[model samples]
Target: MAMPVYNFGAGNPDPGSFPSQALAEATARVLEGAGETLVTYPDPKGHPPLREIAAERFKKNNGIDLPVDSIALTTGSMQAISLVCQAFLHPGDSIVTEEFSYSGSINCFRKFGVRMIGIPVDDEGMNVDALEEALKDLARRGEPLPKFIYTIATNQNPTGTMMPVSRREKLLSLAQSYGIPIVDDDCYADLLFGEPAPTSFYALDPDSVIYIGSFSKIMGPGMRLGFFAAKEETLAQVLYWKIDGGTNNFAAYVTAEYLKDHLWDHVREINGIVKGKLDTVVQQLDAQPDAFLGHSNPKGGLFIWVKLPEDVDPVRVLELATERNIRYGTGKAFDSQGRDVKYLRLAFGYASHRDFEEGLPLLADCVREARAITLEARV
Candidate 1:
């Protein structure tokens, strides 16, 4: 018999929640109306219509005026990360990022022989004070400054923490002081429930910050659409490195049509679903006080990062979870050095209500089992 699996990992969206009918209708319309324009070899920068939508949405939300020429569409946001590294990173060079960041990005930097200098994150998000100290120490030692400070400030991965605007301003100030650039991945910014997320770094300082946004979470990940907006000078470099002529023009056109007026409604619908999942999981975890450590509901993000007792090992906990057909992402995956941590980054985005009701308690049981085994070994 097959195992009854409950996945609490992967930042993917709920498959059932996708508006496939709308997408199909839009796709048919795009081909019928714009097939002649889109079928040809597409521009590397992006389809002009998609770029305009991206720019308009960004400016409308953040109140920042960004030129359409500054936006570049990618196969996905990971492509944007690769282009950024290719443009700025060299072997043995370093970049600053939250201690816990997207693994794909961390791998991208490491593969290119760039180093990740991790800055600690707290409840509010990346600590600007700590960043200043690190920056000062590096200058004092005459060490080469990082290529840029890569951050996912809006909906931080693994930690699901949001950086307040004050810290963002301070970070930008420090980066300016050090002459470092900022690569802000606002991938999860639009998946908000309440008050809008803090202003983006690019909104505050376009000249120094490269901002990224995605249509995956809003429209569903299968769309494979994301955008990067930077100053013209920086955008030129990204375009130069865009080896693939362009992403699927049909995808771009269909998404542009769908987002033309329905974006807010779509975001709100998905946010309600994800927010409900988060609430359900948080409630269940709260009930298992001994087995599960608590985490506050994030302002707006896909994950709810949970802590464990000092003696509990996430690896062991995962081992126990697997036996029960449950899967969750542990913090070690996000750590560059693969250090042990009593933390789990449970993504509620894709999980269903059943996954929560069943998996949460199973997770607590797994944790308790792991805790007892570790305690016995210590004894």
Candidate 2:
């Protein structure tokens, strides 16, 4: 008999928490109320009510007063990112980002032929000092300023570290001094647990920061809804690049209707689920403190980053994990230079409680075996 497969790789949402009944009810209401609109194209900026809802949510959550015109709905945050890349970047242009970042965004930047200058990240998130030093170095070499500073400040992907407000202000100051704009990705902001989230970059300086958020993390990714708030000038450019006739109207309408009534409650429910999973992951990792050197203690996020012993080979771990029907993300997958092999990200969002209880130990065993192999090689 084979061991059951447990995939801990992708940051997928827990299906058990999905608001299926609520969404179905919302969908019926939307169709009954505005079925006629389906005959024509959706508003290019997205369903109008959805935009208003997005802006309202933004203001309520981040304390930023954004006009609806300054927000554009996209298929998902990924599309929003692509639109920004399309509008702002030319081949050989540069972007400043964390040393390890959301791989999807990294891939998107690569597609645009943009150079990414990576800065180190600590517990509080991107190290502003390193960013400034990089800025100084570029200026010293007479290089053009990067197109923008991209950051996933709150509940950052893979690592699960959130930036403190002080760090955000300093980073904003650096961008201002360098005459560079900031692309602030806050898709995971709403999912934070335990502590209150820090101030948003958009709220601190709307003019200099292009803020992006998504329903994927809060509601569910399949809903495929995301939006960005920026200055009118920035929004205009991003809109021009959004060639898709519009984001899905059906999803937008249903999501807007559901969120208007149940957004916070839904967010609380999902956060509880993810937090429990994260706790389980932490506990499992704690059991093997020797094999897993250390892990990030994210306040609220879908992943926990684990550091393996120095001699443990990540490739060998992956190979062993594959045979055992376990999967995870390597640190190199998120690295700007694709050179790191000392870390791995275990996603706690999708796996069931039983899966985490059973699978994580197996993953730790794989690491132990890999470490043994490396030690034998050394001998």
Candidate 3:
């Protein structure tokens, strides 16, 4: 029999942890209370109660005192981001993001025909100094400044690093000086294992920041609920592009009803499960340190970025692993420039415990073998 494929590529939440029963109950409650409203379309901005609940949660969690009207629900955070891009970007315009980021955003930026400048990132997330230097260089070269700085500062995707509030302050200061906007993507903010998230950029200066939040991480992505929040003036621009009539009204009602009562409790439960899965991947990687060079120690989020030996080509490692029925995301996908080939993002949340226990060792072995093969070729 063939060994089962272990997929560690997609940033999918654990299927086992999805609260099906709770959602079903919530769905029933919504129907009983407002079943008649289904005949009419929902508010274009979204269900008012859902927006109110999201605003309250943002205030409670991110320390942002946002009005409910400023919040616009979307199909997912991707759509929220798409709306922002549509509002601000024109062809030949410029934008900035971390050197390594979510591939989905990278693709979105490319689709707009805008120039994307990637700044170096460290453990604390985007290096603000590097960002400032890049901005200064653009000015020196007589180039236009980027329209906005887009950052996944909280539990950043792929790398799974969080930016400290100090860094956030510095970044905001730079944006202010340059007269640029900041798109703060906080989709993974609630997935932290235990550490408290830093103050968000929107909280630091709501006037200059566009905030994005989502239920895809703590809840299931299939629910398809996420939101965008900004000052009324800024939000008004993006709302023009959110022309999908309205996001799914039924999903909004059910999600809001469920999360209003059980949001934090559900967050804690999901974090516990994903954190344990992360521990498994770390433990396996730690056991064979010689096979790898370095890996990120993420406090929270769904991924661990592992860097391979210099000689070990990730393409080759992936090729070998694929033949063995294993799957993972390549670092190049997350890189806007497609130059990073030594890194792999292991998404532990989507895989089962048994998949990690069995597949991780096999993955380590593949790396060692790839490294040996690379060395032999170098000889």
Report lDDT (CA) for all predictions: 0.85, 0.88, 0.87
As a TM-score, model 2 comes out at 0.97
Q: What's the residue-level lDDT of 348 in candidate 2?
A: 89
Model 2 / residue 292 / CA error / Å: 1.2
Clashing pairs in 1: none
- Per residue, candidate 3 scores C-alpha lDDT tens digits across 277-309 of 999898888887877668888988898888888
Model 1 lDDT tens row, 205-267: 999999888877777767789889898889988777888878878888899888786777887
Candidate 2 pairs with clashing backbones = none
Task: Count clashing residue pairs in model 2.
Answer: 0
Regions more than 4 Å wrong, model 3: none
Model 1: ten consecutive residues of lowest lDDT: 30-39
Candidate 1 vs. true structure, TM-score: 0.97
The predicted structure with the larger TM-score, 2 or 3, is 2
Model 2: per-residue lDDT, tens digit, 210-300?
9998988777788899999898888898899888788898888888999888877887899899999888888889998987899999988
Each prediction's TM-score versus the true structure? 0.97, 0.97, 0.96
